[model samples]
Structures are given as C-alpha cells and as structure tokens.
Target: MGDVWAAGDAYEDYVGRWSRRVAVPFLRWLDVPAGKRWVDVGCGTGALTSAVLAWKDPAQVIGVDTSEGFLARARAQVSDTRASFRTGDARSLPLPDRRFDAVVSGLALNFVPEPHLAVAEFGRVAAKGGTVAAYVWDYGEGMAMMRYFWDAATALDPAAAELDEDRRFPLCRPEPLHQLWADTGLDEIAVEPIEVATVFADFDDYWRPFLGGQGPAPGYATSLDKEHRHALRDLLSTRLPTAPDGSIALTARAWAVRGVAGRPA
Candidate 1:
C-alpha cells in the first residue's frame, strides 16, 4: 500500500495504454481554466498530473502522492517549471485552506481507504466555486479488459473467485458515486461514463505487462509462485482472443464525477 515498484516501462507498457486512452480523456473533461492553481491527488508517476499541467496552463500545478518511488519518477517525467511533485497523503493534505482553484485525480480514488474523507478534503482545499473532479475505472461488466481477465481466471480456477471485480471497481456504477458527492457537500454533482480503447500487438505484448508487478492485479500475479504464475498465464493466454493480424483490442471505462464547492450552508 505504501510503496510501488518503479523499475521499468513494464508498468508503463500496460498501464500507460489505459492511462492515455481512458484516464486522460476523463480528466480533460473537467476543463481546468487557464492560470488557476490545480492540485492532483494520488498523482502516480505524474501521468494525469502532467496532462493537467499541459491542459490547464495553471499558475502552479502540484502533484501529491505517498510513494517516494512514484514521486521520483514523476519528478523525472514532468519537465514544466510551473509544476512540482511532493510526497503527501490525500486524507490529510499538507496545504493551507482554499489553496487551489481545481482538484482532480485519475484512477486513484478507488484505492483510497476512505474515499469520502478524501472527497471532503478535496472540497476543503478547493476555493469557493472551484471544481473537484475525479475518475475511477468502471469495474466488472463495464471495463472489458479487466472483466475478461477475471472471467478467464475464475473459469481456470474457482479459487480465483476471491478476485471479484466489485472490490476494485467500486464506482463502476453511478448511484454510490452520486450519493458520495452529496455526502461530501459538493454542489451540482454530475457523473459520466467514458470509454477508451486499448490495443496490443500479439500475445507476448499483452502478457508481459502482467508480470511487471506494478498495480493490484499485476502485483497479485507476480506474487504467485512460479508454478501458479505459469498456470495462470497459460489459462489467460488460451482464453483471451488473439487477432489474425497480431493485434488485440479491449475497451476500458471510467466514471468521471465533477462538482463545484458551494458556499457553506
């Protein structure tokens, strides 16, 4: 929970495709204004933060996360002088009151232990009328790639039933998210589902990323003993479709929620 391995493009290879196609578009929908101060919570590797930095032209853009390893990578990837990366917790941010005009996160909200408090913190840090928007991957049936993986895994080994999609993809549906916004005191909250297409060339291209041990599913696979890992790999490869021309296409979905920080009641 506290650390993520940042050794290579292994994380980038698989996760990056999804980030570019799904996460980026959902984040951009917030339409951050020029010269505003923006904060990106859980700014893993600065992928979403850098995208915000580019799109918003903010007076300053701060990227905050818990991982020193992720911060190091973020520092390297983001070259903007107006941007800075720091180690911080979302539940208890270090910044002062009403410090930002906008706050946004991408695909990191679900992993937070107390998402409600995190949302409240977003409201607290955002100035009056400032916007807070976040994106999380839709789980199970909505996200085709991950759904396919779990489906294939369960068929191979019922013990894999422990790997249910609901646990990870909590915001896949809208009701809980809408209620969360109301509980957090966000005014005029709205939620939208967005899709991104992920493309892979051949079996090796898709399989290698799971071996990287970056995110949750990949981390689970990498933790398995060699025999189990091999068995899982064989099951997945056999189950997933392979294109005649050596390409695979999968769709991923994210629920993007946005709202304004209304005046205190």
Candidate 2:
C-alpha cells in the first residue's frame, strides 16, 4: 500500500500524461520567477521537472525519487542541460538545507509514506520565503476516471472497495493538504483545484492503462486472475460514459496547495 511505483514505462503509459497536464497549470499557479533553483521531490518520471525546465526556465532543476526506474526515465526523457535526476527518499532528501528557491511535487505526495515527513523535508531544504507546493489527485470525488473504475470494481466485488484510493489516502483532499502545509509551518498557505480533460480515444485507451500495473487501480487490476480481470474490465466498459464516436472524455481534478517556506523554529 505504500509504494507501488515500478516499471517507469508502464507508469508513464498510465498516469504520466495526465500528470503532465496538471503540471503546466500547477507551475503557472506557483508563478516562480525564471532562473530560480528548483527541486522536484518524488519526481516520478519528471513530469513537473520537465514542466519547470520548459516553462519556468529554472537556473537548475534537480529531480529526486526513490524509484531508480523512474529516475532513469527522467534522465532519458528530460534532456535539458539544466536538469538532473537522482535517486533519493522523499522523507529524507539528499540535499543541503535551504538550497532551493522552489520545491515542488506533482501527483506524488499521497504516494509517499508518512507524507508529512516528506513535506517537512521540503521545508528543510527550501530557502526562507521560497515556494513550497504540490498537487495530488482528489481521488475521493474530483478524479472521475479512477472514480469510475473503482466504483465499477467495487460494485462487482464489494470487498475491493477497501482498495479504493478515496478510502486509503485521506491526504488527497483539500482540507488535509492545507492542514499538512500548515503543520509544516509554511506561511500564506492556500489550496486550489486543478482540473484537466482526460479524453480517451476509446475504451481500449482507458482499459489498457489499467493493465499496466503501475498505480493502485492498475495494480489491483493486474493482481486479478485472467478471468476475474476480464470480468472487472467488462464491468468497467459498460459503466463508463462513452461517446458515440468511440471516445471517452472525463476530467481529473487535483488539489494544489502552496505556502512560503519559513525559517526553522
């Protein structure tokens, strides 16, 4: 339940695309100035790192993650000279204190075990008055695609409801996110929702990602036996809102929060 990340390609195939969509607006919301030093904690596959390099024009952008597979992918995919990827724990980042002007994560905070520790690490490394921000899927209600998948999965197997992200990660909601930042002693704390269009070309586009076994829903899907997996998939097919043109358009919402890192107590 703590860390499901493996097979970076599979993870990219599943949610990396949507995470990139969220990253653009999330960066815009942060509005950090160009040439600032930035670090992306738990930077799974470098979604936010790439966004920072492209949009923010950071002086330097270091991406840290526990998953070597993801770090390798980040290095290969994000080819900017200003960016670098390293393997590091989110709860104990491998960096000097107060080195970065911006510390940001996207679609990753909820996946870190003891996420508060990771946020504390973010505060520990961010310069005073620097931006400390992150965004995560509102798995409870705002993330429609996963909501559809889990709702269908649980309808067929009521016991599977316990595996749902809405039940498992209480931190993905706005109140909890805001509180976590407050508890970290960050100033000017605020939270907002970021929604993006997740239009799947067809049912195959949506269903195949679940077979990737990267994130939670896909991990649960791949755990089932062949027949049971097929049953669960068929159930999802019927329940999803598919357009007559063989497309499925849904929205994903992530709660984004930001605060200015303050001096240590």
Candidate 3:
C-alpha cells in the first residue's frame, strides 16, 4: 500500500507539529462559520481539523486520511465529541453530495496522484455556495528547510532525486492556481503566498525528525545505508545554521487558495 498515513509518527514528529501551527491563521482567514459541517482532507493528526473546530462551532467535522494509524493518532489528539476521523482517499470521498457546508484541506493536495480530481470531489461534497480552500508547501527553492535538506541529501546520493515536490506544490505560482480554479469550475478564486517559520530547540531537534522516515525527506534518509546516512546527516548539519542555544530556524512557504464551488455563473 502507498498509504502515506503509515508514516504518522515521523510526520507528527518532524513536519506535523510545525505544519499544523502554520496552517492555523490560514483557516481563520477563510472565515469558516460556526455550526457548519466540515471535511478536512489529508488531515494528518487532525491539526487542521482541530483548528476548524476551535474557530467555528461546526456542526460536524470529519477528518479523512488513507492511513489508519494516522487516524488513530488524530482521534486521540482531538477530544471534540463533534469531530470524527475516517480513512479514505482524497480523489474519492465517501461523504454524500452537498452534505458539508465547507471543505478545507491543508498541505495535503500535493501528495494526491491527481490533485484536480480531489479538488472536484471537495467541491462536490460542499453545499452550493459553500467554500473550498486549501494550502500546500512550496517545495521549490524558496521552501527553505526541505530545500536545504534535499539539496544536501541529493548531493550525497543522486538516486534519491525523485521526490515529488513539484507535482505536489504545483500552486506555488498564481497562474497555475488560477488555471486550476477555472478548470474546476470554481468562482472567486484567490491565491496568495503564506510564510511560516519553523523553530527547533536545536539542530538535533531539526535533524531528529528526518530519522522518522515518514515523508519524502525522511524516506530518503531512511533509504540510505549506514555509510550514506552519516554522510547525509553531516551534510545537512553543515548546511543548516545553528543558534546560540543550538536551535535551528527555517522558513517555509505555503500557497493559500480559496474559491467557491460549482459553475462560475
């Protein structure tokens, strides 16, 4: 199974904690209303789903992911009686049509083999005039931390170069997102760049998560043999700057997008 959710622990340990924090403000920006039903796609650990529940007293919040292990952890983190988690694929949602008032996804669309189809499903589930918004990590040169690590790691092993940042973070620029929104038949499309700072207590705090082998960078790290692992680690450490207290601070970009579902009349 290609289920990325199987990588739950490493995801939460490394990117999950920071990624959730960064997405909080974007959810607020969308103005999700109270008492509305919500679906959080790729809701690893329920971070974005939890954020939605916190702001809007949503009538219901369903967090969907492909990894049962991730769903288990997400269930534990979110104590809201109104919230629930499910294991499912993004391209095909199990919910009824027009059953939700809004659909919100975060940092997840990039991993889908067909993001456009997933977006259409998100739109399909939303009630007419309902909102659909999403964000993804910018994996190009400006994404910072991942960029730094990948640059260093790939240099050590040319074979580890198939990471799919480009396909996942495709909305980094405005034109592509604008085109995607149009293609999806969504109206009022808006796309913007959001910056988030990832803080680590130390370089070890930053490096430790890569050992989890959950996501792309971690997968690369875990795939290496003993000799290559040490070299990759050393190379990353050299590339990432350390703080006086031995912490690391890296910045990342998220492409935030929003639009209304259905034909743009």
Candidate 4:
C-alpha cells in the first residue's frame, strides 16, 4: 500500500480536520510566549501552522513538508504574512541551527522513517530553552477511528496487519517518545494524551473519506480487490456503533510529547 502523501485535499478531508482539533490543545500545552519564531515540521495542509499563526501570534512561522502539493495548499490556505511554506525533509531541516524559538509537528511524526533522528533535528534547529513538541494518533488503541478501521481490515486479511500503523509505528507510544526526548538531552521532557471528539453526521460521512485513498487506511482499502473491499466495508458497517439518529461519534486520542532544548554542554 502506498503511504505517500501526494494528495492535499483528500488528506484535509480525512485527517486534517481532526488533527486541527488536537493542535489547539497541543499548542496550549507548550505555552510558549507570543512573538517567538517557530517551525512547523510536516505542516500538512497548514492545520497546525494556521492554528499557530492565529492563536500563538508568533513573530514568524515556517512550515516545512516533503510533499509539494501539501505545501502549495498550505500557502494557498494560510494567507498570513508571518507564515511561509517550504518543501524540506524533516530529518534534515533546511534552516540554520538554533534559529527557531519553537519547533513542532502534528500528526506527521509517525510517518517519518526515523523518528528519533527527526526529533534530534528538531532539537538542533531550536534555540536553547526553546520548546520542541509533536503529537501523533495512538494507533494501537486510543485512536478509535483508525483503530476500528484496522481491526476490521485485519480480521478479514491477516496480511493487512503489517501495514497497520500500530504495528508500523512503535515510537508513537509515550515510553519510546519520552526516551527519545531524554536521549536527545532535552530538558523537562513530558508526554500526555490529547483526546478529541470525532463526530460524523452519518455513516456516509465517515466512510467517504476512506475512499479517498490518501492515508494508510484508505490506501489499504483501495489496494484490495472489489470483492474483499466490499466485504471489509460490510464488516465495518455492522461493527461500528451508530447512534439512534445514525450519527457516529467516536473519540480520537493522540500522545503529545514536549521538551525544552537544552544548551550544548
């Protein structure tokens, strides 16, 4: 299954809206002072970047992503003069060291091949005492939306288990995340669960995004043959807990981690 983030609008529809809910509390957790320079790594569709610009009042916000399509959409959606978008690797940020007062990423860390290296890079670009933070869905259990999808998918096809984010991204857990921060020499490292309500008006509202094939679950769904795909959909339809009015309400939880960049010894 292709996990590449090539489509902007599809992603925005699928996870970007839910991610914005997490971004607000995640930024509040950081509690950084206003007017500080910031860098948003993997700033997909500018959700986190836009929130930072609107709420934090940063002096400047540089948003970086590997996908040019995402960057283009970010630039178009976020018209603030203080915000700029660039195409760059998160593992090796293009900006100079110790330039930004805060470096943060949202819903993007789990996609990185080497999360520890990416966290180290965040530390490298952050000024001493700057805040470095990131948040990712708890794919193993708490991220109910994808957890339910994967549970249904794996029940039908065992091979699909390998593609599951829970199995694929072990670093998404709090222990590994906290260890990575401590190992990087970051100070006051901490991890917390950020929960948000994912309310869908109807089953179609929930199922339509999966057909977009932008994220892992959607990609896997589209990769299957018509028969198996329909079977999986049928199974999910029966399994999901739908309210009396046919609305589906679920909780999505993400593990948010933060630390302060320490001065070089």
* Per-residue C-alpha lDDT of model 2 across residues 1-265, encoded as one tens digit per residue: 4337977898988899899999999999998999999999989898899999989989999999988989988888999999988889989999999999999988888888799999999999999989999999999999998999899889878988989999989999889999999998999999999999999999999999898889889988988899989998888888889999999999999999999998556
**True-structure lDDT of candidate 1:** 0.77
lDDT of 3 by residue, 127-232 (tens): 8888888887778854787888877876876655567455445665667766777799888888887888887888788888888878777776777788988998
- Location of the lowest summed lDDT over 10 successive residues in candidate 1: 1-10
- Give the whole-model CA lDDT for all candidates, comma-separated: 0.77, 0.91, 0.80, 0.91
lDDT of 2 at 72: 87
Whichever of 2 and 3 has more lDDT, that candidate is: 2
TM-score for all predictions? 0.92, 0.97, 0.93, 0.97
lDDT of 3 at 79: 95
lDDT: worst 10-residue window of model 2: 1-10
lDDT of 1 by residue, 30-135 (tens): 7766899988898877887777766667898888888787778789888999899888889988777787999888777777789898999999999988998887
lDDT of 1 at 74: 83
Worst 10 residues of 4 by lDDT: 1-10
Better of 1 and 2 by TM-score: 2
Q: At residue 173, give the lDDT of candidate 3.
A: 64
Clashing pairs in 2: none
Candidate 4 C-alpha lDDT tens digits along 1-265: 5696878898988999999999999999999989999999999899999999878999999999999889888988999999998889999999998989999999998898888889999999999989999998999988888988999999999999999999999988999989989998899999999999999888888888898889889999888889998999899889888999999999999999999998656
Q: Candidate 2 at residue 98, lDDT? A: 94
Candidate 3 lDDT (Cα, 0 to 1):
0.80
